[model samples]
Target: MLVELLLAAIVLVLLALVLWLLTTTRRELGELRQATAPADAVTELLRRQIEAVRAEGRDGQEAVRREVSDLALRMRGDIGGLQQSVASELKGVSTEVTHQLHEGMKLIQNAQTTMGDRLDRAAQVVAEVQGSLGKLGEATLRVVEVGKDIQGLEQILKSPKVRGGLGETLLAELLSQMLPQEHYTLQHPFKSGERVDAALRIGDRLVAVDAKFPLENFRRMLDEGEEDKRRPVRRQFVRDVRTRIDEIAKKYILPDEGTFDFALMYVPAENVYYEIIIKDETDLADDPIATYALSKRVVPVSPNSFYAYLQVIILGLRGLKIEANAQNILNDLARLAGDLDKVREPLRTLGRHIGNAQSQFTEAERALDRFGAKLETIERKGGAQAELPEVGS
Candidate 1:
């Protein structure tokens, strides 16, 4: 477009210049015609010069037209080549853009699918969490109820009578499980009419057991958080344990009543037993409570230790019964041997009589054979006599 515009501008300028030259030449010829002498030569000279200028102008116009036509042809070829090149580049760019759009759409679809799966999983997790929260609420309520029941139990345990009764009941249950009904007596009375909690029969002797022990002081000691405050409570607990031990030892360890020298004091709770014995241990010696109980012949035993003791007693009783059974078996075997000896002579006499009878039967068989031979001889003799008589006849 710019080249075409430049070509048109050049042509217009050349035509204007040619017109101006013609106009100036016509004016000079008119001036020359108006003049007098020698005007003809000047008119001819000016006319020829004007014709030469017109010829030069026509030649210049033809050259300008040829140049403009050639330039227009060259510009057209260049413009066609540029348009094809731009079209090819645009086609390549459009193809690449289409491919990128397809890939982007695929990526978006995949992302949507992944997001949907994640949302579904999140919803399921939320539901599970809600269910867990509901279960946790139920568990919390159950724990509250259990707490109230525990408080009631604590109140009941605070009574000395209730605690003693529970301890005795626990003692009785353990005794019933571990020993035969006849082997243990509950509330066994002494000559002074004082009753021990239970008594185990070991052979002809009894081992007394006491289950009632003071627990209030021990509980108080446990409840006191500060060491200084707990110290006095602990001391009182020790005193209570010692007093119970003394009572058991004096009342239950009665040799005259067929009781063993040592008695058992049953501690219903293992922790209480631990406090009385294991927890009080020092570097110098064993726990004072355990040592004192042992000195007084009152063995303090927790439920576990008491069960183990009962197991041992059961094993000992089994051993005794086996020994008695073995003695009875030996006695029975001896009596059987003596009875067999007494029958020995009669068995010998019967064997002799059987031997004599066998010998007599053999002699009788021989005698019968001899009698058959004699009868045969008589028959032969009779036949010979008969044959001679027939000859005489």
Candidate 2:
């Protein structure tokens, strides 16, 4: 548009210049005609110059119009091609963007599905955890009840008399399970007018067992936390055990009273027994406490060890009973042999009588055969006599 406007301005300026030149030439021609005869030739020459200028101006105008038209056509053609190229590029971009959006939507849907599945699994896990927590609560309640029962038992065991009775009861139960009624005696009195916890009869002797043991110091030793605090309590516990052993040995182990040389000190609790019988590395031969008890002729026994002792005693009793019966069985067999000797002569006499009877019977059979032969001879003679009579007739 600027180029067209400039061209139009140039054409207008050329036309104005040409009109001014023509106006100047006509004034000169009029002036020349009044001044001289050569004015006609000058006017003719000025008119030809003016016509040539006009022709040249028209050709320039035509050339300018042709160039403007060519430029406008080229611009239109370039604009149309550019518009088509832009449209093609826009279509391709739109298709690519739509494909990308479709893929993005699919990815989002897959992600949502995966998230939903994960959420479901998480919910299930939460439910399982809740159930486990409920079970844990129930177990905790049960543990609390058990702990309370244990505390009550601890309180009951604090009394020395109750503890003594409990030990005796446990001892009696073990004796009853392992031995016959006649084999064991509970609270068997001694000649000193004192009674032992129990006595087991072995052959002609008795094994005295005492169940009353001191446990207070032992319990304290276990309950004390620091080693320094436990040291004195442990020493006291050992002394108490040794004292109990000495007392049992003095009271129960009486050889004159048919009691065994050694007596049993029954400990009802395995842990307490372990404490009494534990050995240090320096006491390699045996446990020091156990050795001390042995030296006093009192043997410490826990429930388990006492049970084993009873089993061995039962087997020994059975062997003794068998041994006693064996002698009686031999005596009875000897008497049976004498009785057999007494019957031997009678049986021999009966056999002689039977032999004599068989001989007589054989002789009687021979006599019967001789009688039958005589009868046959008589019959034959009778038949011959009958035949002679018939011939005479």
Candidate 3:
């Protein structure tokens, strides 16, 4: 891989000189510094040259490490996972390089001990060492330049100039649209004593969500100032993040001032969260540092988390819809029950009248049967009187 990278550098420097600033600088510095300085001993100069190249190589490696780590924080899905894997592999490479550097240090000490009496030869050796250092310096510069190419793309994606970020804005939009307009509300200023990212409501319950992140620090650490300067800024960046958490809690988490329940300290950048808590020395237990501080329960959502929460909220909304429909159905059933009661009273009165008419018809038929029996008895008595008179004669 190093051999291929070296060959690529040669083509880029010779044919396409636009991206080969290091090669050009090396050539110019050589031409300018060309002189026969007989006063300076070559061996010591060579040793100094070697040290300088090694220092530059170390710088280049550190820069590359920071660039890759920052990239891991910005990307999502498989790209993010790949970035993480590459960062770990780079760290492994650094450990191996450190071992090699120690070996080189031992070799330098041996050379210095053996060549104590050879000043003229040492001066020539120094010249040769200077030549090697120059090449190594060129190599270091090439590595840094390639790191720059990749880091530039990372910077563009993480920048918050476009009404915050794609991830944050998308999260805010979804929360705003999910809840009913009357039930839940959304606000955006983003937790710097300025904007609240999003707000949600259900019944009398209210919550504020703020997406606060400092993405520029890692890039600045990659590209800017000395270590003494850089370390302090990085520390302050983490401290400022705590201050922002405090600000978000104080400004947005008022139970009586409209936000009920508790507020959400949304970290739209999940990678940033991992960098701070998992990679850095900070812990969740000590994150807030105050009783009223934004709780660790403050939502840490990735793009996936937001979508998942949305799915749950939709289920709740569907439940509410079902409840409303059931209430309407119950009201209709009550109205039908009242109408049925009125019809039932009229049917009962009609049944009573039918019973009275049937009883009167039965009494009239009994009276007619009694009159027929009386007539039949009278005919039988007349026939018996006629038979008795005939026997006496």
Which candidate's lDDT is highest?
Answer: 1
TM-score of each: 0.60, 0.60, 0.43
Candidate 2 colliding pairs: none
> So what's the TM-score on candidate 2?
0.60
Q: Is candidate 1 or candidate 2 better by lDDT?
A: 1
Model 3 stretches astray by more than 4 angstroms: 1-168, 173-195, 218-234, 277-280, 283-297, 354-393
| lDDT scores of the candidates, listed in order | 0.90, 0.86, 0.63
Residue 167 lDDT in model 3?
Answer: 49
Instruction: Give the clash total for candidate 1.
Output: 0
Instruction: Output the better candidate (1/3) by TM-score.
Output: 1
What CA RMSD would you report for each candidate? 12.9, 15.9, 45.7
Model 2, total clashes: 0
Model 2 stretches astray by more than 4 angstroms: 1-142, 280-287, 324-328, 377-393
Query: How far out, in Å, is residue 117 in model 1?
Result: 15
lDDT of 1 by residue, 174-232 (tens): 88888999899999999999999899998899999998989999889889999889888
